[model samples]
Target: MFSFCWPALLFLPLAAFPQNAAPDAAGGHSFSNPATAICAAWAGPATDGEKMRRFLEALTLDAYVSARHGGTGFNWRDITSLLARVERICTAEPARSLAEVWQERKTAWHRGSWKANTVRCREILAAGDCNEDAFFFGIWLYAYDQAKDGRSEATLQTLPQGGGAMVWEECERTPDARLLDVLRRMQGK
Candidate 1:
């Protein structure tokens, strides 16, 4: 009996560990960089939808701050490129490179196609159909939650218009707390 149980006991601790636990992929959305860290401070515990919004928001805020300092504006092309980098870091897909996904997302954005935008994002999360992957699922949840809250429009508008960079020149800036509050409520905290 001890011999039979030994195998089970040996594997019990391993079972408690996450099977997919791997180090975060290098590049894109790492917590190492100062800018990413500032953005992540608000994003760490956020839901999937919140993560996506925050990711998009970071770009907008960066542009806003840059422009406020009298710098040139950021273009959609450049912003999309940055997002592509983020996509690469967030997932482990070989096909459909983040750059490609970024372009697809841009196309949907220009068409004013929310469904397409959502579908694209969902694809990014799953990297394919019917995926149950944790990271993808998490980000998808963020998008879904953001949509349900009716805050996407406000966020979209807050971004610079005409593809130019936007800067918030104000010395003091705060993230939209309502969004964060909703996230906390969703998290049951």
Candidate 2:
């Protein structure tokens, strides 16, 4: 009954949303070929005009993680966000390979350059649907907290339960609080 979708698909109409333009569902990271865009089918005056096609052959060749009906249970938003970034980069530098640009800006263009802030998290909770964005944000929070505490990785023991319910309960308790603050409190940090 539910479907997986990003916040108004920030990727498709990426130009419309510039950096620091209101907190929306956002995250960024890198993987696969080093090029900014692993496989860019550039076709016209505008890099994103019609006829541009991205085939799965490249994806299948260098597939990282796959998405399932229940979602990948990973910080996929960051990865997806990174691809979106690479796309933008590739558009500007069409001559570069997806891997080439990706390697160049992997660290510089890491996640948080365009992250989904706490306000957006609250809005996602208010909507009453634990979509991928909401769910991944929760996982993102848990992992983020783990990293902040100097933990090498987020283990099952430390990961909070209740998924979207947990986020909803926490966000509702502190309507104006930042998502990281809530996460810290939940983890007793």
The positional error of residue 33 in candidate 2, measured at the CA in angstroms, is 22
- Residue-level lDDT of model 1, residues 116-157, one tens digit each, is 112333232223222223222222233334444433322233
Candidate 1 Cα lDDT to native: 0.30
Candidate 1 versus the native: TM-score?
A: 0.22
- Top candidate on lDDT is 2
lDDT score, residue 177, model 1? 23
Give me candidate 2's TM-score against the actual structure: 0.41
lDDT of model 2, residue 28: 26
| lDDT (C-alpha) at residue 145 in model 1 | 41
Model 1 ranges with Cα > 4 A deviation: 1-39, 42-52, 83-189
